[model samples]
Target: MTLFRHFRLLPRLVVAIVLLVMGVQPLAAQQPLTRDTSFTVASALRKARKDNPTITLAQPAFPSTIQAQRNLTYCTVGGRPLQLDIFYPKAKRSRGYPAVLLIHGGGWSSGDRSHHAPMAQQLAAKGYVTVTVEYRLSPEARYPAAVTDLKAAVRWLRTQAGTYPIDTTRIAVWGFSAGGQMSALLGTTNGDAQLEGSACQTSRSSHVQAIIDVDGTLAFIHPESGEGDDSRGLSAATRWFGASKTDQPALWHQAGALNHVTAQTPPILFLNSSVDRMHAGRDDMIKKLDAFGIYHETHVFPKAPHTFPLFNPWFDLTLEHTVAFLAKVFPKRP
Candidate 1:
C-alpha cells in the first residue's frame, strides 16, 4: 500500500522532467471561470450608466488646449493606407515633448482610432504629444497583421519626431481592453524580429519607454485568463487568433505578453476593472517583473465596469495615474 501511494507522484515528476529536457515551458496555470461576453465595454457601460445617470464619457471633444491633426497616412500596406491622428500641445516645449501612443480595445475585431481620442486629447493637454492610431481588425486581418500594424504605427510615430515636437526617446504606449494586451506586448517585444512590423519602411525603432495596460489580459491561456472559452461556439479570442486554442496552442501562446517578459521590459502600469478574469496573468507577470527589477504599478477599481475609462470618475482616476506614471518614467526634458 505504501509503495503504491508513493508512485502516485511519479507521473507528475516525469512530466516536469520531460518538459525541462525538451526545453518546453508549460502554459501558465488555468483559472476556472464561466465565460461571459457581457464583460464588454458597451454592456458594462450601459449598466454602469443606469446606476449613475450622471456618468459620461471622458473629456469634451475639440478642446482648445490642444491642436488636432487627423488622417495622416502612417503606413501603406499593399496599397491600403493606414492612418493616425495626432494631438499636439498648443504650448510647445523647446526640448521636444514626450509622446504616447493610444491603442483602443475591441476584442481585435471592432474598434477605431477615435475610440481613444478623448484620452489622446487629455494627455496632449498635459504636455504629452499623443497619437491614436488605426490597425487592421480581425474581420479583415489576422493575429500578426494587427501586431505588425501597431509596430508600423510606432515606427511612423518615431519618424515623425523630427517633424513634430515628439521626443523620440520618451515614447510610451497606452491601450484599453484588447488594446491593453497589445500595449503590454509592445513593451515586452521590443526589437523582437517576429513582432517588429515591417510595413512602415522606416529604419527607426518601434520601441516604447513605458506601458499602460488598462484591463488587458497578459496571457490568453493562463490560469487567470478568461480567453478560449468558446462556450458560445465562437469566442472573440478565437476570431483574433484565427482558430480555437485547442487547434493553435502555440499561436495563442505567442500572443501572450507574459511569455515575452524579460529583464529589458519597460515599466508598466495596470489599471484594472472589477472583473477578475480580466486581471488574467497580471500577478504572475508582476512576479517576473519583480524578479528582473523592472518597475510596475497596479490599481483596481472596486466595482467599476470594464469600460470605466470611458466614463467620468473612473476616467479621472485613470488619467491621474497615467499622467503620474508617465511623468515618473519619462523625465522632464525642458
Candidate 2:
C-alpha cells in the first residue's frame, strides 16, 4: 500500500520535472505586459512595411516599436474590474504621444477589449498610443453604464499619461458598431454632466479631440431606411436601452448623438457601408456639423458590408483614412 502511494507521487513529480526542464514561464511572464523600452517607431514601421507589403495601403508613414500592455485594470464596476489594453510606441521622445481609445463592437452586449486588438496594434505601430477598453455590457448594466465606463476610461488614460508615453491633451475615441455609438456620444457630449457616470477619475475631462464612428447608429429613434430593409423588430438599441421607442421616447432621443452636437463638438470621421441601416441621422448630423463649421469627413465603402472594418482589404483602407485623419488632427511630435 505504501509503495503504491509513493508511486502515485511519481506521476506528479514527472510532470513537474517536465515543466522545469521545458523552462515554462508563468502565463503573465511569458506574455510580458510592459514593452521593451529600447524599441523605436522607425524600426518597427520599417519591419512592418517589409513583412506586410500587401497590407500597406499607403507608404508606411510612422515607424515606431509598438508595445502592448494587456489587461490593465482601469475601473471597478459592480465589483468587476473593468480592464483596458494599452498599445504604445516604445520609441523614447521628449513629449508624450497622441492617443486613441479604441472601442470594440458587439451590439453593446458581447464584445471585449481584445476584440479590436489587431486594429489597436496597427494603430500603435503607426506611433499612436492606442487603448482598447472593456466596458460594462448590457444584461450586466444598461444604457448609460457603458457610456459611463468609456468616460471613466478616458479620464483614467489621462491619469496614466505620465506613466505611458501618452499626450493627455490629444486623445481621440474610435469605435466600431456599438462602439461607434459610444464614441459618437463621447464626441458630442464633451462637458455634459448628466451623461457622465459615477466612476472614479471623473476629475479629468472625458473629452476627445476627434471621433471616428464606423457603421454605428447615430439616431436609434429614426426609422430604418435604405433598400431591402423592412421596418424591423426591436433592435440592439431597444434592448440595450431596456425599452422600446414608444415606451421611452425621451430617452431614445436623448441617446442620439445628433441631438447633442454643438459648436464644442470635436472633428468627426464617419466610415460606413453603403447599405447599412444604422446610419439613420448621418445626413442631418453632417448638416449640423457644416452649420457649426466643425471638421467632419465621411467614407462609404459601396461594396463592403456592415462589418467590413473587421476584415482585410477594407481594413487596410480603413487604416489609410484613419492614419490620414489622425495626422491632420494630431500631428506627429518633433
User: Residue 79 CA error for candidate 2 (Å)?
Assistant: 1.1
State how far residue 4 of model 2 sits from its true place (Å): 30
Please, what are the lDDT tens digits per residue for candidate 1 over residues 35-65? 3333444565678787677777676566688
Off by over 4 Å in 1: 1-44, 50-54
lDDT of 2 by residue, 87-159 (tens): 8888876688888999987777665666567778888888788999988777677788899899999999889
Poorest stretch of ten by lDDT in candidate 1? 28-37
TM for every model, in the order presented, reads 0.85, 0.78
- Which residue pairs in candidate 2 have backbone atoms (N, alpha carbon, C) closer than 3 angstroms, thus clashing? 40-65, 41-63, 41-64, 41-65, 42-63
TM-score of candidate 2 against the unseen true structure: 0.78
* CA lDDT, every model vs. true structure: 0.85, 0.79
